[model samples]
Target: MMKTAVIYATKTKHSKKLAQAIGLFLDITVQNITENPVLDDVDLLFIVGGIYGGASMPELLAYIKTLEAPMPKYAALVTSCASGSQKQIAVCNILEEKGIKVLDEFVCKGRILFVSATHPNAKDLKAATDFAQKIVAGGLK
Candidate 1:
């Protein structure tokens, strides 16, 4: 079986919760990037985070930069942002630059104070799980 890991760099807890849901779905533990977790030979990496000021957190991007080639051979992005637009292009680009194959992405509404406050709800969690399952099941490649 291919080894997989779920990691998140989150300002708000929404991304952490989404990572937790995906972790639970896949029976794996979710990691926080702020903790400076190191990955080793990960076959697939699920990078979960939120968009702040129209971009992914610098912390997340920096962590992604630290990842060298071949440890994470593949990646899937899971994002929580008010725009809900599969809009983590920076994250995608960095991973690709490192030669990590980004298979797909999952985005859902995230709370911005009163805006989208009800988001990352049950429906979003379910969709994130489904997306992860499809990636692990090789549905993306």
Candidate 2:
């Protein structure tokens, strides 16, 4: 079996929820990067998080810098204010700099956590899950 790991940072659980859905589809483990940073054992790594103020989370960036895993297949998922914008492109560039080969990138609209009373409703959740399936099927790559 192809071993896969979903490593992510989540503030309001939207990204985490998406990761979990992906993990279920791929039969892989879901790890929160804040609680864990070591990913040496994972064969395929899926980095999931949100784009905040045009960049990835600081903690996620730090973790990526410290990673020493063999150049495994890598992919990224993000909840963003605008999909496929400069922020997403920046994230892809950063991952490439870390020597992680980005296979595909997926993005979904996310409501500003503190500024919005409501966010990531059911429809958004479904979109995330569907995207996860696509990644697992190698359709995104």
Candidate 3:
């Protein structure tokens, strides 16, 4: 029974919504990255955010830097332009640099500006919840 904390930064609310879905599935509360979340007592942490300018939101990365050394067990979640391939890589590199074991990653669809619209909708939220459930059930193995 791991105590998990979800920290996310979202501009358009898509990432926040995904974090909420995951938090709801895990029975945990979702905290915004701007709120300066702590993970001392948490067994698992979910770093979630939206991609911007071909990378993750600056606020999210900045928050991650404020964490103490020997970072806790964690995973990455993102609502990005594509499938979050680039964002995941960037995040994983940062986490791994701190010797943190990144268990897994989850990516949900997001609406791009004036490009592909209608994302992070009902279906996306459902998928996010389903992904969270599976991740929780598997214990990040």
lDDT values, one for every candidate: 0.89, 0.67, 0.73
lDDT of 2 by residue, 1-141 (tens): 555677888776778877777777667778898886566655567777877778788887777776764645566555544342434565567678877677766677666645433556666667766776666677423
TM-score of each: 0.94, 0.77, 0.87
Cα lDDT of model 3 by residue, 27-130, tens digit: 88899987898787566777777777778777777777777954576665545454434455667777777766777776766877655477777888788778
- Pairs clashing in candidate 2? none
The best-first sequence of candidates by TM-score reads 1, 3, 2
Q: Which ranges in model 1 have alpha carbons more than 4 Å from their true place?
A: 139-141
Q: On residues 1-141, what C-alpha lDDT tens digit does candidate 1 reach at each position?
A: 688999998887999999999999999999999888778878889999999888999888888888764568889999999878847899999988888889989889998888888998999999999999888887434
| Candidate topping lDDT | 1
Error of 1 at 66 (Å): 0.9
lDDT of 1 at 100: 88
| Candidate 2: stretches off by over 4 Å | 82-86, 113-118, 139-141
Name the top TM-score candidate.
1
How much is the lDDT of residue 103 in candidate 1? 94
Candidate number with the higher lDDT (2 or 3): 3
Candidate 3 Cα RMSD after full superposition onto the native fold (Å): 2.1
